[model samples]
Target: MKLHISFKISAVVLVLFAITVGMLVDVPRLDILNESIRNLFYHVTSWFAMVFLFIASFVYSIRYLNSGNEQHDLLAKIFVQVGMVFGAAGLVTGMLWAKYTWGAYWVPDPKLNGAAIALLAYLAYMILRNSLTDSLTRAKISAVYNIFAFVMMVIFVFILPRMTDSLHPGNGGNPAFSGYDLDNTMRFVFYPATIGWILLGLWISELRFRVDSLSQKMNDDLDIKSDRLDSIPRLDEE
Candidate 1:
């Protein structure tokens, strides 16, 4: 499917707005997380986008399993690939935020550990895909793995964080995004930033899908041409 121009436009607009407002808006001067709190707009938004992309991939994997269509499989793979990019960005930003706030880049926080494990799990999925030689088998197995990994990722990133103690906000005794942490001013930028990053991820996945589709088509055409050439009977026997 062709990507709509409006989607691209909206992503650009929202991202610009996020950067502008995130920098311009005056946040309350907290003890350690004074200016660094602005990372919330970029860091949190990237993870939100990653989650959105993974959800899209998970749905496409289900469709692939039901219909056995390679297109759906391709869509699922591309979505995960894009999701990983955003996931990596989120990790980097989170590390930076952690360094400033927690006095260390790598902490024993459950949420942080969960995020790392989730990313590693997805990376393992990619490795599994590459290890397979048969296209159909690869698609089927990877689809199943994708669903399983996604569920585990959700449990790791969302469930485990809340269940255990963590220095990150919105967990343990820390103040959540609501109330004072994310006041009226920050909300304006945060929501749009999330939507914008998700849209951008979708745009990237679409582009990758198109390229993969074209390559598949070209390979199929070559195979058909080779078969046709092989079918022509030689006159040597007659």
Candidate 2:
């Protein structure tokens, strides 16, 4: 769970640089986006991070099922948790952008609804895990459910949105921002922002994994001690 110092420094620097560019650099104003174009950095980048985190979660879930490694299950769980957080951030930022550009905060747009449904699918994974009592059973069943959740997310967030007309850029016949920004200045900011956010998500998940692993270890030690004490005969019994 310990991250290298280099990665820590790199994440901090990339995010700060991206923020500086996003805030200070001037972008070509489109008809609808106008000043709200700045949100592209935050909103789109958050979705990118979510995808990266969830991809990791999916891989770990499969690994857990195949290898039966507790570490893999723990990683899958933590990654999904952090991925949802970024998904929520994407939703909030997208809503703000919609308020300014689309004339409403929440629309019946396919992309918007798809994103919401994707998050709900992940929420179901959390609920399913909590409902199971046995540790091994919870890990195995949740790992299977995690695969389904990831697929549902892909369909809702990526596939369905594009299959239908969407107000979102680069989806469902909508011209992407790249077409509007003739100078392509946003590319410089957008790419770095996406990478920064992905790294930031990993950093957060790593910390959570560390805390959970330690807690599990402590709980296991206590259980062992209690079992040993119970096995010892009391004075009254003797």
Q: Name the best candidate (by lDDT).
A: 1
Q: In model 2, where do residues sit more than 4 Å from their true spots?
A: 227-238
Instruction: Give the per-residue lDDT digits (tens) of candidate 1, residues 73-109.
Output: 9999999999999999999999998888888999888
Question: Across residues 50-86, which tens digit of lDDT does each residue of candidate 2 receive?
Answer: 9899999999999999999999999999998999999
Write down the worst ten-residue block by lDDT for model 2: 229-238
C-alpha TM-scores of all predictions:
0.91, 0.92
Worst window of 10 by summed lDDT in candidate 1? 229-238
lDDT of 1: 0.88
Please state every model's RMSD to the true fold in angstroms: 6.1, 5.7
Error of 2 at 232 (Å): 20
- For candidate 2, give the lDDT: 0.87
Clashes of each: 0, 0
Q: What is the overall TM-score of model 2 with all chains considered together? A: 0.92
lDDT of each: 0.88, 0.87
